[model samples]
Target chain A: MTLYFMTFILFCIGMYALVVKKNLVKKIIGLVIIENAVNLFLILVGFRFDAEAPILEEGMGKMVAFVDPLPQAMILTSIVIGLGVVALLVAIAIRIYEKYGTFDISQIRELRG
Target chain B: MIELHIILFFMILAALIAVEMRGLLNSVIALGAVGMGLVLQFLLLRAPDLAIVQLVVEILILILLIRATVKLDRPSESTLKENWAYVLCLLLFAGVFLWFGYRALEGLPLFGAPEMNVSDYYISNAMEQTGAANIVTSILLDFRAYDTLGEVTVLFTSIVGAIAVLRKIGRKQ
Candidate 1:
């Protein structure tokens, strides 16, 4: 409920910045927001109230009171992927600044083709 | 019933506000919030895959922004008649989108809910084909390997692009 709306709002906001903003940084921010909103949405979708972490105890035959473990694993993978993207993006940004002499995306108007 | 929608309304308002704000960094931060929110939604819907992708993309994007902004300065809040006019046009655009949204939800998502219950289908027979406890992986990589291949290609393209971009810089330096 509250979570769903928040996620959507985040997505729309990111889209807006990506579309409307001329600053490269702002647009990047917009991209980040979009990514976060989607991640949050995914997490929220799988949540179950009062469910414990999916941990199996010794001599416990698949205890029934456990939250799904898949999401947690997915989150870990997502975090790793995010790190990779961030590193690549940062490298790109550094190069763009050196070449363009500015971070204002509107001014990086060399690409007309 | 109405609680979720009401919250969504507020969130939309916030998103619009962030977009309208002139501060580039602030807008980007707002965008991060949006990404986090998406992950939450993915979790709620039991879709961890989507959430993970979102998180990874967000991190990369944020780094790109910060790096890109190292030499850039924020634009001044200069008022212009055309800008306001454009803003008005955007408002109109939002109105159109709202109408479309309403229309979309009218019969959406579950055009034929009973017949297309993917969860049920996966649960009942996924083990037979892939023998993995995680049905999603089997569906994504085995039952639907094409989609997975597409995803891998997209990532591959990005990695290659990044490498090319970096190599050009090395040559210039």
Candidate 2:
């Protein structure tokens, strides 16, 4: 229970860093932290105490030993998506840095509307 | 377990606020954070399929963000309170939504009987009807193919928009 709340706090902290901090790398890192926190939370959601892999074979009938496999499968997809988003964001970050010569974010100026 | 989701929700809201601040990088990070929290929420709701779809979209968004940032200079911070009234109005709208959400969540009925679930209808026959082991795939590609087609069309349109916007940059690079 406490762990769950702590994870949430970690997420909030990451957001704070991403929001209030001016460093580009730190902002990216904060984004990573946020993504990781969510991934952790998802894992925790499907977690069952002392549970085994979800695969069911012969002689496992009526056995309550398996945790859910659905979340893991979903997590796999999410991880892939996270990779893509991270890559795109990083690429954009690099471009912004080149154009503005600074990562302070407040210094970059072209996007309106 | 429930507490976990509530905390993630708070985290998401905070991240949203953070992104709305004066830094472009911070806003991008906040966007990612919101995505993360949304993934967690999907997991809690037992909808892994939606989580995966959203996750994939986030990756593309990150790429687009990075591309734009690299191509253009960052916007200068405007300290002037230009949108205070709009922000206040948005806050009032959010309050209404929050109250509505609270009421909806509180009124959810308990489900103890599997026989009462409409999903059971699909659970038993989805594979047979759609020839897909993944229920989400079956529903997406079979039962809801029209909507899926629409989504694909939207994707194609976005790709066109990207090309149109980046054509000049492509020539330079």
Candidate 3:
């Protein structure tokens, strides 16, 4: 579907930012974008037209059409992982700024071989 | 469907602006807008649980980024040739991945027709097995509880790592 292709395009945009940006914070932002794009893609894969949320009601007999919930659960874990990774990245960025006194990757070349 | 497409378009635009913007703070804000667009898309796609999680996580990330970058000066720009190299590398990477991804997509079951026997079993028996009305919750807490446990461990480890890293910086100052 067009929608799924569009999500891939978004993923590519994130990849572009990640590779092309020089600022450390911008790189982290790009990483976050890539994480979100994957989550969106997974959720989109699980969606069904006209299907309700996968919540069963009391005495609602024979639920016919509920969207898949497995991908939703997996994505929940992924979103949480993204949060942790971002937090760690920001902390590291702060430390890198403290040591190097700059946020530009080009200028912080101590680690370059 | 058209509405969903419109939102996806806006999301892509926001992503572009976020990537291309000059100011770091403005780019972060744009990224937040992209997150909001994703939240809306999740809601529209019948994933309320993901929508809620995304909303809270996005706000928290925005706060963290703002706090980290608040006192820093403007980032210096890289050289033009380096930028071109970066762009070319990404284009090549994207082209390869896109081709593989499209091929993979064709092999996948069509949209709205999930063919997983595991999911079917969960859908049919989750209520009786877990007594949870929400299938997502049941799957998360009851069926695949070990995965949740592992996820919690990962979160705990990251928190510890962050605190340790930040604490070192404080002591050095």
Candidate 4:
């Protein structure tokens, strides 16, 4: 229960950064933070006390305890997706910097508008 | 549980530093620390596959962000003071979200005892059905192969978009 709340708070911190920060790179950092927070929460949902990794050993008994594998699989895909999004975002940021000559979104806003 | 608690605390702290720090370079390094803490948390939580992927992805992201920061960042660039009105509005929204989110979270199964109606089937029969020792791999590559394909498409599309966006010239214009 507490852990879940902590995860929520972590997400809120990310939201805070995304909303409050004026720097483009800071906003991207916030975005990644939010992603990591959600990923942690998903894996946390599947965690089991005293459970081993989900891999099956050659002679392991059927009754052996293993953590849930579903969220792990989902997180694998999410991690890769996150990499792509971050790459694209940074690329965009670089271009913005090249055009506006600043990483501050406020300056870019005033310049463009 | 205690170990998870410590790592979670570490992650939150690092994330806070990453967001609130003044130096862009320092903030990026703090974000890297946050990712490392996440990798540790994943391993502690028995998600070896995620840990490995996360570690690799974190390295790539750090390299990319550092390159952007070093080459493009100007020392004169400083964060502007955010409008207090906007900050207050955002706080109000976040408060409402947390109140409702807490209620929604109350109905979920407890932390360590998830409702595994679907995963139960996957765990038991995945090995024999897919001939894979790792249930996660089996599920990723077998039961949900279509999802994997979509994921690949997304990756490819994003990479292509990034490459196109970063190109020096577009259509000779």
Candidate 5:
């Protein structure tokens, strides 16, 4: 339970950075941190104490317990998604810097209407 | 459990340093440390698959971030003040989220409990159904194949988009 709360706190810290930071790269870092926190939370939620990895070995006896594999699969997908998003974000940031000549969010107000 | 907590503490500390650091290179390195901590936590949680994926992804992200920021000038200090209004708003949001999150968590099973019906089915029958020893691979490739397909598509689209954007930069130069 404490671990869960700590993960949430980490997530909130990421949220603070994402919402308040001015640098585009810092915001991207925050976004990745939040993604990781949530992934960690999900993996933690599915953990089983004293459980073995979710693999069935040949000639093994009937298993009474194995760690949950569903969340692992889901998190795999999510991690890949995060990778794609981060790559794209960095690309966009590079282009933005090329155009605006700065990485500050406040100064890139051309879209503000 | 104590070990887990220690790892979490370091993870959070790394995140804080990453967010507060002035140099982009140092910040990126801090974030990579946080990712390493997370990979360790995943291993401690009995998720070797996740740990492997996280390790590779973290390396990839670190490379991308360093490549993107290497030639760029150091970012100017932000002028946005950390005022009371920001703190109050963040506190309110955190309070509401933690309250509701705790409430929701209470209704669910505790850590390390086999309480999820769907997961139970998958764990019990995956080997027999798919003839795959690794339950995670079976779940990803056999049971939830459509989702995997969609994820691949998403990845491909992002790669194309990144190439296009970077190509534009080259053309402009």
Candidate 6:
């Protein structure tokens, strides 16, 4: 319960940064924070107390309990997807910097065309 | 349990610093700290696979962000009063949003007591069917191979898009 509450707070902080910050890099940072918080929430859902990792070991009984593997598998894909997103976002930010000569959103508000 | 709480608290503190810090490079480093704390939490949660992937991905992200920040000669600055107003509005919105989220979260299974009906089947039969020791690997590579394929496609597309955006010129003109 407490863990979920803390995760929620983490997510809210990210939202605050994303909405309130004017710098493009800061906004990217907020996106990263939000993604990580959601991933943590997924893992928290799959977690079980006193469970072993989901690996089959020789001589281990079939009934031995293991932490859920479904979310872990899904999160593996998600982590890679996050990398791709961050890379593209950073590239776009750099392009914006090149054209406008600034990373501040306020200064870059005008459209050239 | 206590350690988990400590790390979560530390992560939140680092995120605040990352968002509020004046120096761009410092803020990026603080974000890296949050990633490291997340890696630690993954380890503590019995997910070594996630911990490893997160560590590697985090290193790449930090490097990219640091490079981007270091290349800029001037610092970013914004007006203080406007930022404060935004923060106050955000706080009011967050308070309401969090109350609703709390109610939604109440219906979920408690921490460390997840219902694993589906995964139980995977754990018991995955080894014999897939001949793989790691259930996660088998599920990802065997049962969910199509999803993995889609994920790879997404990565490839994004990388190509990034390259396209970073080119010296977008058009022949």
Best by TM-score: 4
Lowest lDDT 10-mer window, candidate 3 chain B? Answer: B73-82
Q: How well is each residue in A17-92 modelled by candidate 6, as lDDT tens digits? A: 8999888889999999999999998998899999998877899986778999999999999999999999999999
lDDT of 2 by residue, A1-113 (tens): 44454555556556655555555655665676676666665556555545444433345444444344444554554455555455545655565566567666544543321
**Regions more than 4 Å wrong, model 6:** A110-113, B76-85, B169-173
Return the lDDT, model 3, position B141. 95
Query: At residue B15, what lDDT does model 4 achieve?
Result: 92
Top model number, DockQ:
4
CA displacement after TM-score superposition, residue B4 of candidate 3 (Å): 1.4
lDDT of all predictions: 0.54, 0.55, 0.87, 0.90, 0.88, 0.90
DockQ, in order, for the candidates? 0.24, 0.09, 0.76, 0.84, 0.73, 0.80
DockQ, structure candidate 5: 0.73
Query: Model 5, range B1-173, lDDT digits (tens) per residue?
Result: 89999999999999999999878888899999999999999889888888899999999999999987888855464344455677689889989998888888788678777566798899888878999999999999999999999999999999999989888454745
Pairs of residues at least 3 apart in sequence or in different chains that clash in candidate 4 = none
* Candidate 4 CAPRI grade: high
Screening candidate 6 with a backbone cut-off below 3 angstroms (N, C-alpha, C), the clashing residue pairs are none
User: Tens digit of lDDT per residue, candidate 1, span A1-113?
Assistant: 44454565566666666666665555555665565556555445545555533333346444333333444445544455555565567567767767776655655775422
**Model 2 lDDT at residue B43:** 53
Candidate 2: C-alpha lDDT: 0.55
Lowest-sum lDDT 10-residue window in model 2 chain B: B109-118
Task: State which candidate, 4 or 5, has the greater lDDT.
Answer: 4
> Which of the two candidates, 3 or 5, achieves a greater lDDT against the reference?
5
User: Model 3: residues >4 Å from true position, as ranges?
Assistant: A110-113, B75-82, B168-173
What is the clash tally of candidate 6? Answer: 0
